[model samples]
Target: MPAPRKYPDELPERAVREVRTTSRPIAHVAKDLGIHKEALRGWVRQAEADAGERDDRLTAAEHEELKQLREEAAELRRANEILKAASAPFAQELDRPRTRPTRRSTA
Candidate 1:
């Protein structure tokens, strides 16, 4: 006859609280809890992935905004350069000495 299948044991209350509070490795706690390492690892990984994805989405949005801002700054710089190039000749003309015409005296 086949041996009766053993059910998994419930984890200790204190250990459960510790796992919740400290964010320690579930595999380590699982050892004390007398559960399979793979099962605990699966739960931990799923929870971690879910939490990480939430923060990742926010980071991605910030990155896209930064990229757009950088492009706008670069475009403004290019416009400023063009304006400077266009104004250089006028600036030089203003800097040159002005010649005055002598007035002729009428008798």
Candidate 2:
């Protein structure tokens, strides 16, 4: 699980908007908003990625999809392990030789 956010949900958007519209330095904006400058800078970068302004980082939607795909891959691997474990006994049985009973002559 993700750690709880230190700032409110709206703060990032507000800070990014402030920086974009006012052209103020990130440190100054962060100081005015009581936010960490690095965090605000990261938010601005993410916002730019979301807006298609940057290509170096994944967009928010792509990030979410990648997270979901990773979870799905993990789940599939777990299921495959369980299936292999469950089939092991049957596989061993199949590998063993079976003997035919000899017919008895009538006396």
Candidate 3:
């Protein structure tokens, strides 16, 4: 299982909002808050994305959906592989012609 979120969604939003309102450099605020500068940078980017600032990153819901779709695709592929493996011997048997049994002679 993955670790629980270190920072909740609202916290990041609040942090970004504070930085935006105060016009303070992220590094300084992040230092004050004891958070990594890069983590704050990511929060800012996510905030921008939510506000339609960047097109490069997916929104949280879109990101979750993409992850689920990828997992479903991988599961379907595994099922197909398993079906192929399970049917291989049966397929080989089907390919052979059936022979009639010989009749025994009665004296």
Best by lDDT: 2
On residues 9-96, what C-alpha lDDT tens digit does candidate 3 reach at each position?
5877778887889999999988887778899999888778778889998877778899999999999999999999999999999999
Runs of candidate 3 with Cα error greater than 4 angstroms are: 8-10, 98-107
Tell me which residue pairs clash in candidate 2: none
Candidate 2 residue spans exceeding 4 A from truth: 103-107
Residue 107's C-alpha lDDT in candidate 2?
88
Clashes of each: 0, 0, 0
Ranking of all candidate structures by their TM-score, best first: 2, 3, 1
How many steric clashes does model 2 contain? 0
Question: How much is the lDDT of residue 103 in candidate 1?
Answer: 94
Ten-residue region with minimum lDDT total, candidate 1: 5-14
lDDT of 2 by residue, 8-104 (tens): 9999999999999999999999999998999999999999999999999999999999999999999999999999999999999999999999999
Full candidate order by lDDT, most accurate first: 2, 3, 1
lDDT of each: 0.67, 0.98, 0.88
- Stretches of candidate 1 exceeding 4 Å from the true structure: 1-58
Q: 1 or 3: which has the higher TM-score?
A: 3
